[model samples]
Target: MFKNIVRNIFLEAENANVKKYVKQISGADKLDPIIVIKPNPTWVANYGWIAYNNAMDQFAIYNLNNNQRRDKNSRCIFHFRDIQELHTVQDGICNRNLIPNGFHVPQGLQANIALGTNNPVPIGRAYLVINLEIKKLEFLEDKKFFYVD
Candidate 1:
């Protein structure tokens, strides 16, 4: 199901840059990466604050701000700390204008994550699952960033 969505995005995306990025990442040998996302205020307001171990695997998320060419249904990501600050803002504003942040897999767990062998690295509020063999990007869940014990 999720694979089809990403496949459609790769095939039907209007943005040239997005297509190019998809090509690059899809074909790359390494997919050890992190998906950076700010808190979704709507989700929090409706469902209360985000908690650790919460699965945030929402594919085909709507683009709230479609102001840029690269803002083509991408995830919420700006600076690294936006994950922490997103839950604190009272205003409706969010990290919709920034580029998506995904980084290379660390050396230690690259094999485990790539192979999907009980590799659950703590990435702040991000839960990212990447299977390079199938060229699939799966989101795990989000966790509470601030005000946690």
Candidate 2:
């Protein structure tokens, strides 16, 4: 069925070699700031994005170059109180932002500015993972790339 095909794609996308290549291209030591969500009950997905928060303190901050704080106010800021705010914002804007096919970029992948700062301008990516359990005889085809910048 279609579920099988999707599962195969996901498997290939997350293979060992693919992960190694992604790591090299992204230059990320570790995959942090990973978001896992269960949007449905049939399939699970995994995504990777850049982390902007201090790993030790678990605090998120805007990566800026200078002292200018004007842009900081306009860009999305994340805090303990803004968890849901971030999720909602991401859900709302996930579909509009899609990365063009090039280099190691895979199909059905997207990116957006999850958070920003005024100083140097933030340059990072975010990741997402989904888990689903399929049951019964069903044909689920609702697939779209979702992520926050």
lDDT of each: 0.33, 0.26
Q: Model 1: per-residue lDDT, tens digit, 89-136?
A: 311111231111112234564664443222123223433334445644
Report backbone clashes per prediction: 3, 15
Evaluated against the true structure, the overall lDDT of model 2 is 0.26
**Shift of residue 80 alpha carbon in model 2, Å:** 6.3
Models 1 onward score TM values of 0.26, 0.20
Off by over 4 Å in 1: 1-31, 36-39, 42-125, 135-138, 144-147
Worst 10 contiguous positions by lDDT, candidate 2? 39-48
- Considering only N, C-alpha and C atoms within 3 Å, which residue pairs clash in candidate 1? 32-105, 55-141, 56-141
What is candidate 2's lDDT per residue for 37-121, written digit by digit as tens? 2121111111212221112112122222355331122121222223353454344332322221101212223232322211121
Off by over 4 Å in 2: 1-71, 74-77, 96-105, 108-123, 127-149
